[model samples]
Target: MKVTWVWSIAALALVAAACGGGADIEVADAWGRPSPSVAANGAFYMVITNNTDSADHLVAASSPACAVAELHESMMNDGVMGMAPVGPAGIEIPANSQTTLKVGGLHVMCIDKQAEFVAGDTFSVTLEFENAGTVDVEAEIKEG
Candidate 1:
């Protein structure tokens, strides 16, 4: 009985260790707006949730559906709204928090799209992180 208990405890410890001590970043609710027929640019939005003890950065993004993908942030000056690139470092997600990429906020810019963005369409976007590595998520295109 004692030997069995010891082995059980050791197994549990190994399991916990395997799953702990890492930046756990998750992507959810990823969606994009349907682009106009003659538009070459599009945008993607989603929620990035970080559940780890340390902060992480979304370094990059890519998709075969677009010629280029970049992280961008919206800016407003004197009631004029504009946008700028978020740079190659990408957006940061603080420890144990969530960052949302919305229509007029932070978003993924798709340049020279390979196809038209139509409603009810889905595509894959691979996101690279500083700590969590790469994650590929399917993004749904909808009319906005």
Candidate 2:
């Protein structure tokens, strides 16, 4: 009887978590462009989808290949497009919505790349969220 009661409680907790829907995040279409060996920096792109009722923020990003990885944005200034690091608040992921990290927009800035981003190669990047915890994803090297 005690074992049955414990199992019942555990099942209830699982159901509650799924139905509550708090900070459930998923990453898809993660890819990075080819960077020459001499290049100092590279970028990664992906679609971050939030599948819950509560919103969350992507606080940071890191990888073994980059000395520094940061959330960055590209915007137009004086009729020319420039790239800069994102603010301290990081990137907002609205509830039940998705954000795209693409060229000419928000992306993961891989600074001082430790290795070449060659085509057909793969690397790992870890994304840290304010509430959803950390997600490890493989980034495929490709050309646009």
Candidate 3:
């Protein structure tokens, strides 16, 4: 009887995790730019919310739509705005806070795009997190 009770508790825990009952990370507002047919580069933007007491980091990303996918930040230099690649550690999301990846800020830079991005098109981007493991998000291409 004790063995069965322990197994039931373990099964319930697995089910809760599978349903995101213990998930500390949440993604929303995932979007990307619709590049011209001749363009070879694209970008993605979104909001990442951390609800847990511990912080987390977005370590990496993968997508079939781009040859190189990485985090980047836009900065102003000498009155000119330019983009630079993020560090190996990637971006950080504080506990009980949210991170916004938007234009003129933090965004996912997709270089050497496999194909041109168009309106009404969607693509998958798998984001690797420090504690959340991997979460795949569907990014919608829209006019920016």
Candidate 4:
């Protein structure tokens, strides 16, 4: 009986290990373009790494530096390049994959700037994910 119980416990532990678990979402290379005080908007970029077994969504973003923060995308429309908001649904980060927020692509649009985002200036932005929760990222303003 003792032998059988020990074997059953070992099997359960192995199964648990194989199932794995959720991993924290990682934000890296956080940066933003320098904007003058007169400018009403700025752009932020970064790489989001999803290390979990399940996929996640970057549902929202916010910052104290701007009156409005939103996910935006740039694309060519009928031969004319145009930029637009990504909507409230937000962007997706696949499981075990990386999503990059870059210029001329997907990015965080900081509108109605409360201060100038000049070179060397830093600010914090909160990224809200569907499963990973909220993460605070410090973004530096500089030239890429």
TM-score of each: 0.82, 0.83, 0.81, 0.82
Better of 1 and 2 by lDDT: 2
lDDT of 4 by residue, 8-68 (tens): 9999988975664434698989999887889999989999999877889998889999899
Candidate 3 lDDT, 40-74, residue by residue in tens: 78889999988788889998887988998988999
Q: Candidate 3: deviation at residue 26, Å?
A: 0.9
Model 1 spans > 4 angstroms off: 1-23
Residue 11's C-alpha lDDT in candidate 1?
100
Report model 3's TM-score to 2 decimal places.
Answer: 0.81
Q: Find the candidate with the highest TM-score and give its number.
A: 2
Cα deviation of 30, candidate 1, in Å: 0.4
**lDDT (tens digit, per residue) of candidate 1 on 1-144:** 999999999999899868755448888889999887589889999999888888899989999878999999998889999999997778999998999999889998998999988889998999999998998989999865
* Pairs with backbone N, CA or C atoms under 3 Å apart (clashes), candidate 1: none
lDDT of candidate 3 at residue 52, scale 0 to 100: 82
Candidate achieving the largest lDDT: 2
Better of 1 and 4 by TM-score: 4
**Order of models, best lDDT first:** 2, 4, 1, 3
Clashing pairs in 4: none
**All candidates' lDDT scores?**
0.89, 0.92, 0.88, 0.90
